[model samples]
Target: MDHRGGQVEGGTPDGESLPALLRSWRRRTNPRGIPGLATPGRRAEGLTQRDVARLTGVSERWYGALERGIEAEYSADFLDRLSSALQLSPAERRALYLKAVGRLPTLVLPPEAGMPEDVDEGLLQRFLDNQVPAPAFATDLAWNVIGHNEPLLEWFPWVTRQENQMRWVFLEPEAHEQLVNWEQDWARPFLGQLRYERARHPKNEALMRLERDILASSPAAREMWNRREVVEHSHGALRRLRLQCRRGQEVAVRIVALRPMRSDLLRVIVLMEDQRECGGA
Candidate 1:
């Protein structure tokens, strides 16, 4: 709350400041409100430094120092876990990192918001295109499908139709038909992954909107979300997919998801059909 140290650009463009942002996020969050955000004693209003420290496995005083914007050193791993506990999304994590470095997260803004896509998106597109005849697509940390190959559109054109991958999975009527084992293979794990994502970026407008919309529209989705399951990873595996575009078509494809080394938000997925094992004519 004390900007007397010097006003540094952070949070909102209106110069909301970092400590304010942290405190705001904390105040709005309750122990039972969001997943992984629950702290032991303070469910009445907001989380305390003690709660954050307890969650991050650090001392209360140490956590307080960072929260107060004191010149303190923090490990990436520690920051990551702390972000997870507070349910800080990719954008929030980046912003928090920036504040720690005496810089603002919005220091470099691409045309779009929350896109740390400083990597060569064109080159990545080329790589995705090279996987022709196979379904390949890339998604940001929030699970927004950023890029994809033409082949991928044949089956998952829905993914391209909409930006949010989780929304498409849950909201689309055709999802049940597209994914053979919709409940177990697709929906459950995907929901858990979304749970993790939601926890990380509790303040993301798009994500928050999608969550509200889904919860209101679908009872199933609401139940899954309320369960508050946290999945550390969302790697796709070999599975059967129904080619909705093709009549009487079911393909056994091994779907693999890989995150780029440059940023945690960027993820690439490639689908390989096991033609030999499945005896393709």
Candidate 2:
């Protein structure tokens, strides 16, 4: 590819080109949905190249060259803007980057990577309810507690009232008392997990706000936040904590984290008793 003009020097390996994709996408876009567009007496089906260029903050000539597959250097930002102006889906956007820049955009996670906004709360609740004897709860991308079973509340009664698992872990005084090895096992890894999520989904404002609140409210969280530890998930880890139902006795459990096939953003976490440590609880 010509670095200066951002043109493709060689054909894309997938047998697709940027110009074809751009034309196809632009042709499929409806002008009526776009605000500020004059739709009367229009013979064309989709948006014109000039209209897309205007929306994308580029000159019509430049956009026309792109459509003509003229050899020119293109910046990732410009391509991203073009993708947005054309209303490309996540997959289509990826294809745009791959066809144009020879790589995928670094920051934007696919829509399927997180919980869908229209997820069925009742279904999630039922899924948790089915866990029965095992303590189970559901959390979103930001670790917000969306669903829980009675067994989970038995283990951590605070889950009944808490909205976010991360907030409760970092800010609540009860967390320190109930979590065994609070600093090393619970707080550190959990904070690292939060950091990982923040990096993975930088566009998520809630994660940023949650981090700021925890850092401001808890000295422990502030201290751990600086350590820059990173963990994706605590799945399969054996952890010991004081269960509300068991009172003074410390119970050991294995953590199981799962993402629903239908919605990757929603997490279903189940905690099973460590048979040897708790004697089947």
Candidate 3:
């Protein structure tokens, strides 16, 4: 199985087919292999074909045909069930399905040895320097404020109190009242990004701790987490935030994210508003 570049059409030098791989996987996932099932089966040691069929709601004969590669047409949904039955990781699942159809590609991540703890202060300063009129700050991949210019700190002092962005937004009462369109605008994407990150890096201790603290500290945060929405932070995404000034006037600010490098640790956010939009505040 030539597993290079997601192309898997012609068999390897040994003529190994995807069905061969499936069969091997099938042999490993018996009922006992799964966490809670009874292991009273007679012949096979691992999950029988019947166990997988029952768990995935597919006909035993149909699943058998699938395992045997006798069926040519297989839906992604069916492959998904098979993937779950085999307890394949997300990458493994994708690779298996792709191979089954003779395509070759796989996702690989860089080693996590040198990830930065926070965005660089110099980078944040440079970003803020370039955006003199706009407020800008650099945050970590998890949206924790790492560095912000005086202007941003002056405007959003609450950023200083909480390290986590979502925590500050939902836990702080002032954020709900100050941020216009809180639910429809920021909360949805913020929560979604958190969930997405959690799935991608389930073993991240900092992320897990942040989630636990937020869930315990704020009901709104818990509710949002329960919704299980997932999203990625995209560059140039437009966000609107309403800020209340000390003089009791409202200002509408447009927020944009700036990535100085491909690394997720540094994200500089710029806030801009038209002079007219500034109003009395």
Candidate 4:
């Protein structure tokens, strides 16, 4: 038991107890005033225990006890939710996970803000540009087509014309025609990614604009967004995209989104043809 006579949970908070840390951090985190929570809550500013419970998907009683430094244990998943609830840094989150579960979380988590000021030119352009035949491009967090190669532009004119992929996917009528399995393959996954990125960078003005623009264009997109789904999307399943071209050809390729180790906001998408489609690219 602690000097306060409360049962110690994982490890003694010592002079720096978990409950004390929670209480301190909770006051410092103002959800309503912050860029998080797309829609602000009715509860007063700063994170409440109830808010933590809801965000972490744990019972108020359970979260409260943990907050009070009582003996407790939770799964790694619970720690993930708890980390988000507390809006902790990756390091801080890791520490919390160890404190709660006596180990690191099974799932990998990106830092709250890991975007580099600039992605090295060689990595972004020089390398991807050489990836011939296979359509390749780079995008910012907003999914804006900041750079691309001749093959990608030649295959998809709409991509060249449009500045942002999200805008094209939802607003441009041609996107539905070009991307096969529109709802399942392209739209849903992209929607989930947008939601995930937004959660991490809610205050970013450019990102906020992107979200507003997307919502303004498509009700279907809005409905999906409201579902509040988030996914850990690095490189996703192989997808078949129907090129919006003269012949309307369809090709199966794995689309990969690569993030540089140091950068949070930069993403590179490369198209790879299936082995059967070899000699085609």
By summed lDDT, the worst window of 10 consecutive residues in model 2 runs over: 1-10
Instruction: List clash counts for every candidate, in order.
Output: 5, 8, 9, 1
Put down candidate 3 lDDT per residue, 1-281, tens digits, no spaces.
Answer: 23322223344653445666666677776666465576465555566777778877889988776666553556666666677677663345546656665442221111131135343445446767777666777665556665667778777878655655667887788888777778767787788877877887788755676678778987777777778888877445444455555454566566676665556545677877745656534
Worst 10 residues of 4 by lDDT: 106-115
How do the residues 1-281 of candidate 2 rate in per-residue lDDT, one tens digit apiece?
Answer: 34322344336545656666777899998888788775688755899988998898899999898876666567877887887678765557667776666666653332333446667666777888988999999877877676689988878888656767888988788888889999999999988988888898887766777788899999878887899999999899999988667767888989999987776577889998887977754
Query: Which 10 residues in a row give candidate 3 its minimum summed lDDT?
Result: 105-114
In Å, residue 227's CA in model 4 sits off its true spot by: 2.2
* Residues 153-185, model 1: lDDT tens digits: 887778635766777778888877888788777
Runs in model 1 deviating more than 4 A are 1-113
Worst lDDT 10-window in candidate 1: 104-113
* Colliding residue pairs in candidate 4: 115-264
Off by over 4 Å in 3: 1-120, 234-238, 274-281
* Candidate topping TM-score: 2
Compare candidates 1 and 4 on lDDT and give the better one. Answer: 4
Q: Which clashing pairs does model 3 show?
A: 5-104, 6-103, 6-104, 6-105, 7-104, 29-47, 30-46, 30-47, 31-47
Tell me the deviation in Å of residue 92 in model 4. Answer: 41
Candidate 2: list runs displaced more than 4 Å.
1-115, 279-281
Error of 3 at 120 (Å): 4.8
Better of 1 and 3 by TM-score: 1
